[model samples]
Target: MSERMTTATGTRDFLLPDLGEGLSEAEIVEWRVAVGDVVTVDQTVVEVETAKAVVDVPCPYAGRVVALHGAAGEVRPVGQPLITIASLEGGGDDPHATYREEERAGSGNVLIGYGTGHGGSGRRRRRPRLALAAEPTAATADPTPAATATPTTGGATGADGGARTAPLVISPIVRRLARERGLDLAALHGTGPGGVIRRADVEAASAAPAAKLAAVPDSPAAHVGLAPAADGDVVIPLTGIRKAIADKLSRSRREIPEVTIWVDVDATGLLATRAAINAATPDAPVSILALLARICLSGLRRYPQLNAHVDTEGQRIVQSAGVHLGIAAQTDRGLVVPVLRDAQQLTTRELAATLAETTAAARAGTLPPARLTGGTFTLNNYGVFGVDGSTPIINHPEAALLGVGRIVDKPWVVDGQLAVRKVTQLSLTFDHRVCDGGVAGGFLRHVADCVEQPALLVANV
Candidate 1:
């Protein structure tokens, strides 16, 4: 970040626009242009990581780069000037113009919410933009080990102790890291330009010898030992997607009064149906998940109460018109739920295709923010991890989550005779605020009935 500079051509500063909901900051992963390079409108200027995924931010104005504000690897806050571009010699160019104005008239692309293309943009209503802070913003540089700065009630005091001023810290992730590690932010000196504290600065301080040895050894032998610390004693700092997941789960647990009800269903018919479908159409086969997804839709239609969210703000249960089915997907980035819009309308084969494509995108870290949101209900098949049953926490703001356990052969009574059957456990965790145990149990029983007899879904299909 830097002061808005103006010259003969009038330099227009481009601030980092808000990427998604609740994303206040992003890390500058890489810059596409250097100082003096010519840039065009809609051309990607930089790539940034904002807890969710890495996104390429496009320039809305074509100009010559006068100066770059933040460097690579530095986290910058939304509405902070990322680059200073000398306005081109044209009548439309205005040094005082903001990114929002240009984006509305030129690109017309809405970054979030309902829009045109599946993975792209469409025309959107103009939203109020955050006004620029009246000051010369500090530039963020690479991080280095330094003395931690002391936390003050107000901003940092000037070197002469004249006036209280704000520190050059921008990212909340940095604050979270410091807070979790109990590191003194005021004690650590910043390596960024204008004393901006980068994430690396907090990380280095967290790993500092003094900080690591803050805990005293329990025994003299432990103190004298040269062996590595125990696994349980190691500190694992939460960051990026992992941190987002932790925050969401914590909020769900704290806010939602949820109750889980599970039933072990004989999935023999469901398994048989999947096998027949796959064998009949080997070229475009259906999966067990697709079959189960269809059955879940049927149950949701019967008990519409389950396909809803507890809107605490509105003090009402918002029942959705269409089901936005969220499939819990596990990837290297962590567990993420990719939602399928109007999932109740999709055929089993279509669901299989969507699931495959969405899963691939999640694994490759290319899933857009639009694809990761608006989940009315979540289906967590944790059975892939080899678990029998789990009390799943409902996805925050969403009322219910269904957990499916591994489908394995088990002893069961079939028509009064004991026999080996394909069995799986189905757990439904719903928000008590939205529905009672009776409603939840009925929904679970419907799903179990479908699993036990695949014909139960024929009417709906």
Candidate 2:
């Protein structure tokens, strides 16, 4: 349905602007203005959360808000009218009309598709009504009620076994939540207005059986022929960053023919170098991850093939000119890979500072969307989890991901003699479509070589 509501007055509808980088919708976290409040151009009126990050949406036109569309916590699609504003008393001309005029003149002050001489609200066409259907006569007619009676399409499985109806829901995030949990939208009753299913409902439905089972006595399991859970289980619904990670990983597994290759590296030299650097520059301490990142950058420079992505749609392998290195950081919002743009150019100290800043921002959920994307390769330091190694799935759309494991002391043959040294496992998972084993092996070897001798990076630099 058209989100715009109009009257005889000079009114302008401020539709939600496209937040760019494939963001289709956002949840209204809060509204800065209410109805009847006067707002200026470029004034942020709402804070919204996309699948990726939280963003503030600014209204483009200056006027008195005649109406506000969505409330806090409501997810609204892009191009939907966020607020309707009317011209001031005796202003005469509609701001929308002025915007359209400027749009025709090729003004660039507008959001991507709004008032920028592009498209307008493109609503889905309604299916034609059956001709034999009885038309409402004057006494029986009720247009408003009839329009309100229209059914909405929503989630995955329906209540009717084979018959599917559109799930009555508005938020994609909610739909994603239900779909992930395998909950049937039609089977559940909605508590929202107009019988719309919501996130809370899906979460409750998913948690219901677990909660009931938890409440059941252990003695009854034998009578009921059910095995009792050894440990109490908690069903945490995937949302926000957790959900995003799940979706990306699932897609990566499905689409990318990934192969993991690992090598044990004697990181005795790398650790000593890091310690020496920190000792000399206590104020600007270098992290182990930074040194490893520097090593990865050097490796990427030698084998640029692994430092690129495959565009399956275009059937092309796009090699990035410079490494936009993605550092995998586990934050409160789950795992996020924040990219350091043009990392190939940054010195070890600069890389350490940037890595620290980005990691801090990611953990704080304050990193910008730009910093969270466009990675040619990912460096995952799962060593923080104290694991020896893992066959990690690649961060989708990227050609490869390098995993670093915990550095531990292990006995090894050094100079043909038994010796203990700091050792770490390095795993590289690469997309098979972009390169073969030869290229992947070489890249992994380069990284391992650097770890074994930190001076390798200095020579490459």
Candidate 3:
């Protein structure tokens, strides 16, 4: 959901509302409504992809569509105008005047952080009423002139030579590029839809001087020492989730003094325990991951230091009051961590059900930004990838990550006799700054003890 701003005229500018987990920006995925369409409050107008999830952004104001900001694949910083709408009733002065009882089936607040608007069941379309009197300001617009989706255009209203408007730029990244290169955005004519400044526009501008320098012998461009792509090389520009993962992992590696400790645990008892529970209740089956999560929660209770964040600015370790367990699930886009809040408070059955729901949502790519962030610790089941072990990077600020490798039958010693048991490797990677090896080892061993002896869980109960 988004916030709205009032103008002297009937049109209101809808700022991209805060998609919480406190994300700063999101890329426009697609537009659900077009210009000339009528909308109700909480009606999803656009879908945006944050680093963590794809969220439906509902417009807070109920009105006729005037213009859309930013095209698909474009990233918009939070608080930037998302759309323009003209109120259909009440002279556009009061944004909520058009609300009807039937249109709102939901609690009126749907988007996790956007509390200003309620959800609507349907929207009615009418003949185009609002004129494209003003061209939607440039680069930030997210529609297409094409039929499939959003509006792509030239300028909207106030384009006359008499009135000066700020240059339209596609996204904050494009603006950042121009700033870093000291390229004046106003000087460049945007080639994107609606004459918005795009990244290419800035690159082309920056390359002009470099292009000239390249022609001169022994010029600075040649000595810049940048490598050129080979013929037939497929260059993939990092965007969206991949770029976010890179940034986070890069930050973690750069900031944390990390250490990984691992142990091979006999999971035969855990497997049998799962079978017994499922056999007793065939309708409600629990996953191994859920059990592992329960174990992690208990271990955190024993050693709270691992369930915490290092407040580097304050030089303090903030132990979380409750476990907000993050589960890493791989999707087509990338790895996403969907958090389960207050995980320690749930019973095994409750935890399993919620885990199933959360993981399913993650795989479907429908999790809201709020559900994707704010984890005290992360549990990664790299075992699904058929790997035996990994030195995983901690999910930044969080003190530790627990990784589970694939479970396989391996030879083992029990009661001084050779035996084959179901075994898995458990690895813990923690921030050394938070606690020493003793604390880390204690937590890891506690988790292993639970896995090796599922009956030990009764003690916690």
lDDT of each: 0.72, 0.72, 0.76
Q: Where is model 1 more than 4 Å wrong at Cα? A: 1-9, 88-237
Alpha-carbon error at 355 in model 2, in Å?
1.2
Tens digit of per-residue lDDT, candidate 1, span 316-382 = 8889999999999987557888899999888889999998898877765567787888999888899
The number of the candidate with the highest lDDT is 3
Best by TM-score: 3
Off by over 4 Å in 2: 1-7, 90-239
Q: What is the lDDT of candidate 2?
A: 0.72
How do the residues 182-233 of candidate 2 rate in per-residue lDDT, one tens digit apiece? 5655567788777777677877888887533212123221212122354864
Off by over 4 Å in 3: 1-10, 87-109, 117-230
Q: Is candidate 1 or candidate 3 better by TM-score?
A: 3
Measured over all alpha carbons after superposition, the RMSD of each candidate to the real structure, in angstroms, is: 13.7, 15.0, 12.4
Model 2 / residue 232 / CA error / Å: 10
Per-residue accuracy of model 3 over 1-461 as CA lDDT, tens digit each: 44455667768888887766657998886677788877766566776877776666766566789899987667899989989998686544554465534334532545654554354445432211111233222222222212112333434234255444556653544554565565656667688766777677878887886533213233332212123379855444566788899999999999999999999999999999999999999898988998999999989999999999998899898999999999999875678888999999998888899999998777655566778889999999999999999999999879999999999999999989999999999999999999999999999999999999998877875
Error of 1 at 239 (Å): 3.3
Better of 2 and 3 by lDDT: 3
Please count the clashing residue pairs in each candidate, in the order shown.
12, 4, 26
